[model samples]
Target: MPRSHWLDPLARRVLQATGQLPPARSSATSNNALARPEPALPSNWFLDVNRGSQQQWRELPGCTDDMADLLVRLQRGGVQFAAADDLFRLLDLPTDLAQLWAPHLVFNWYGDAPLQPVRSCIDVNNASSEELTSLAWPDQRIHGLLRERRLRGFRDLADLQERLCLPASSVEALIGRVSFGQRRAGPSLPPRG
Candidate 1:
């Protein structure tokens, strides 16, 4: 009753050579249609189609029937590499696959600015002593300036420097790094005690 029992060594070899011994089945049909010889894997396999055959020889197993149907649909639809990355991400594919397809992912792939340096905006009015200390300046002078600003409100940058008795050149140098802005005006200062 078993199909293999009917096959002898020579007969099996002959059948295999002629592509006749294995009776055509759905799996075989699907495999035959999808599988093609891939000579070598490329550096980034998903991106370099020419390096590896366009054929997807192995199917992702343990997929539900619905998932299998979806994969077939995706194959027929012909996914762009970028789109494929998103699809795999949405489906929560393995990390290896995600990394493999990351180069192809369109979300943040390429743009005019290849690299952009980070710049931070410092709030002069609300920055803590620790935050102010992080700047390239004397920590004592910064602390003194912050104290002066807290006691007597600064109308402008010049007023702030004057209140703290700091040098005009120092203030000028720090202008680009520092920013002055009005605070949100908390609770009307509790009617000044």
Candidate 2:
């Protein structure tokens, strides 16, 4: 057989013999490659506002030297915010700062709890009627409406009511809830203490 005719089949057999190919690069990884670096930490004390107040705020254990230097610079420059806030934003503080500074500062700070996970909508183009109805969307009318809309190729949310038999109100309600992208998985449970 000619090389060109045999090459494709030979390559396929080799690939199949290898079991599975390596996983493709994730979207997050590709996005990170294109993103700019985060802004650098502010080092100049003259620019800080919390310069020299006697608040006796807690510091990260073993970070005394760096913290003291940062505080002194801020105080000398007459900066007027809590050292904690400045440090928090400057370092991109972890979700739990108490854990980071444990045994040093008996962390008494309280803030709003982290945001609850939001439920993402299904991709109307590829979703089955069962999946569409599983969202507790009232009735089969909605599912049939979505199916019809998919066939016509949805241009946008507004086109749903115009192109399908769905009620205008129902279409509007689903507008903010539905998405063209895949649904995200729910948040993972934290490890037991």
Candidate 3:
């Protein structure tokens, strides 16, 4: 004979106020903790100066409206910053501010935060005519200077006029863009007896 399930007459009334529910099962598929999205991270120092919005720059540590404006102007002006020192020189800011902001700055026109060991400029003493032609300077003027430089290198900016017979105004204009430093020399040999 099959067993029959049955309830007592008072079972419904006795259990009326006592709610009953199935026990919760541990779930690997369902989330056990609250879900939260990650926050947006801030840009690095170089990026903050090169590409940051005016408001973002103002929000940077120790940055004022004047400072932020100048940074934006310098970036837009196409100035190539080779290091934090260049930024300090360009802005003429207080030493304290430069020191404070240096950690967040980069030395190149690009926004990447790579540390550049040397500031690059056109090496006038070693550049080929092809390289000189790439510059904004006048082709004819550069050619004349190149010929003179090949014969005997320029001693200084002042020498351009004397050595190549270039105009004073042209030399003055090119001085800021060109580097007069000698090329990096190879390792020296030991002194001979």
Candidate 4:
């Protein structure tokens, strides 16, 4: 049977209003309209990667206590995830679990939280190794960045990608979060106890 016949007119209207149904599709040579594949509605639990607590993560489908703890650690370390795939990649989460939680994951995605802004960024040239870890930037990458910054230093965003061998997509995702300032390079000193 055609999709239009699947639901009565009133049901279609209500679904459309709530965005629970996709827009109807029309056949090429006929006035007949069929419903497109149903779009997945937004999940009730949209967890923000930047601000979600361990408890909140544990509440997500398929998320275990260890996984939630890891997530919270990443957030505290200053990792600014661009998307769900990034999170999955960083943590090496199982494919099935990632899929189960994909619809509910978001990076810096706004939702119920306190009335304070969250900043997701790090200064490549000035940030220490520990600070760089916040974005889950590889340890080798951090070492390379620090060594290079001390030698010649980054002049602009392009310099960051070129010096660090970062991809264009990574640089683009950091547009607002990055600062290309002229802070002088200094000795790589250990964090004082």
Q: Give the poorly placed runs of model 3, Cα more than 4 Å off.
A: 1-47, 108-193
For residues 1-193, write the lDDT of model 2, one tens digit per residue: 6567768767766776773332244789668756853222223212222332223332232334444554454334322232343344433346565244323322232233322222456566556666767556666565565546545545444344445544433542453345554323432222459
| Number of the top-ranking candidate, with lDDT as the measure | 4
Per model, how many backbone clashes are there?
0, 8, 2, 3
TM-score to native of every candidate shown: 0.31, 0.28, 0.32, 0.36
Clashing pairs in 1: none
Tens digits of per-residue lDDT for model 3, 28-87: 423442253222224453444555656777655556777667556444443345455545
Candidate 2 Cα misplacement greater than 4 A, ranges: 1-118, 138-140, 181-193
Summing lDDT over every window of 10 consecutive residues in candidate 2, give the lowest-scoring window: 39-48
- lDDT (CA) per prediction: 0.47, 0.43, 0.53, 0.63
Give the per-residue lDDT digits (tens) of candidate 4, residues 111-189. Answer: 3332222257567678767777776567787788777887876765556766677764455455445565566646765
Q: Which tens-of-lDDT digit does each residue in 33-133 have in candidate 1?
A: 66863223353434331122223322222234454444343333332222343345334568765555445333332323222212354666766666776
Clashing pairs in 2: 49-79, 49-80, 50-79, 50-80, 51-74, 51-75, 51-79, 52-75
* Alpha-carbon RMSD, candidate 2: 22.3
Between prediction 2 and prediction 3, the one with superior TM-score is 3
lDDT of 1: 0.47
